[model samples]
Target: MIDAEEKIVQMADLEIDPAQIAAYIALLAEEIEASVDKEPGVLMLHAVSVKGSPAKIRILEVYAGRAAYEAHLKTPHFLKYKLATANMVKSLDLVALDPIAMCSK
Candidate 1:
């Protein structure tokens, strides 16, 4: 059965150089999407950028619960992405969110 309980999630806002935006987007579109789908308890994974500010990327990830979210950080793809983009990213802001309500019925 699907878990309907509230979940804690992490949102990451990343700012990159304009020149590297295209490459970052292409890399994520080709690799990250499929990789994240394989993770357990990952309810949703999304990546978006601000209009006209291609260098700004925001990722919203929701997990089944705290354990699931923690597990995701240990995944290979997450580590790889962190390493690969370390130099490309100019700034990163991460926030933890507490979900109060969710309607998926």
Candidate 2:
């Protein structure tokens, strides 16, 4: 078993169809809320759009570990978001991250 998932991070870059921005955002927010509320392993799912680029979106996701990440993929909310936004998404890119140190005041 792969333990220690609290350090897992993922960066997703998305390009959405301008015509579907509102609808896609609604679905994405709904799913994010559901995942964060219902899934214990989901640490965070933050979505943002580039300045002056409404069609460009980016998401920063943090999970407890590998297991948690995989579990997220199979969740109902994630599936719903995936299916609903398939046509709206023009491109998607996922990047994995390794944590070294974090400092906060």
Candidate 3:
């Protein structure tokens, strides 16, 4: 478990147009992969589509700290993603979270 006070977790709730789901997912997956590969401070980034609802999307993003997240915003891949998907995203909600506890095997 990480120290909750130091960890930065963000929940991204996205609503996409049905016609843009495939393209949005492709872009999202690519960004996630690139973030994890290129940024050591990016702890986790997992995206999922809601079952039976093709336009609804959810993502759980974890970073080492606030500074890490700040840096993530300035990365080339992230900038590219933000610019590329500007029109494809119908709605977006980003929620900052305090990690109570987390585990992975």
Question: Considering every candidate listed, which one attains the maximal lDDT?
Answer: 3
Off by over 4 Å in 1: 1-6, 100-105
lDDT of 3 by residue, 32-56 (tens): 9999999988999989889999788
Q: RMSD in angstroms, all models?
A: 2.5, 2.8, 1.4
User: TM-score for all predictions?
Assistant: 0.80, 0.88, 0.93
Better of 1 and 3 by lDDT: 3
Model 1: lDDT to the true structure: 0.76
Over 1-105, each residue of candidate 2 has an lDDT whose tens digit, in order, gives 334335588889999999999999999999999999998888788899999998899998888887888999999889989999999999999998775653345
Candidate achieving higher TM-score, 1 or 2: 2
Q: Which of the two, 1 or 3, has more TM-score?
A: 3
Ranking by lDDT: 3, 2, 1
Greater lDDT among 1 and 2 belongs to 2
Q: Output the TM-score of candidate 1.
A: 0.80
Q: What lDDT tens digits, residue by residue, belong to model 1 across residues 2-51?
A: 55565657788999978887777776675467556687678877789989
Ten-residue stretch with the least lDDT total in model 3: 1-10
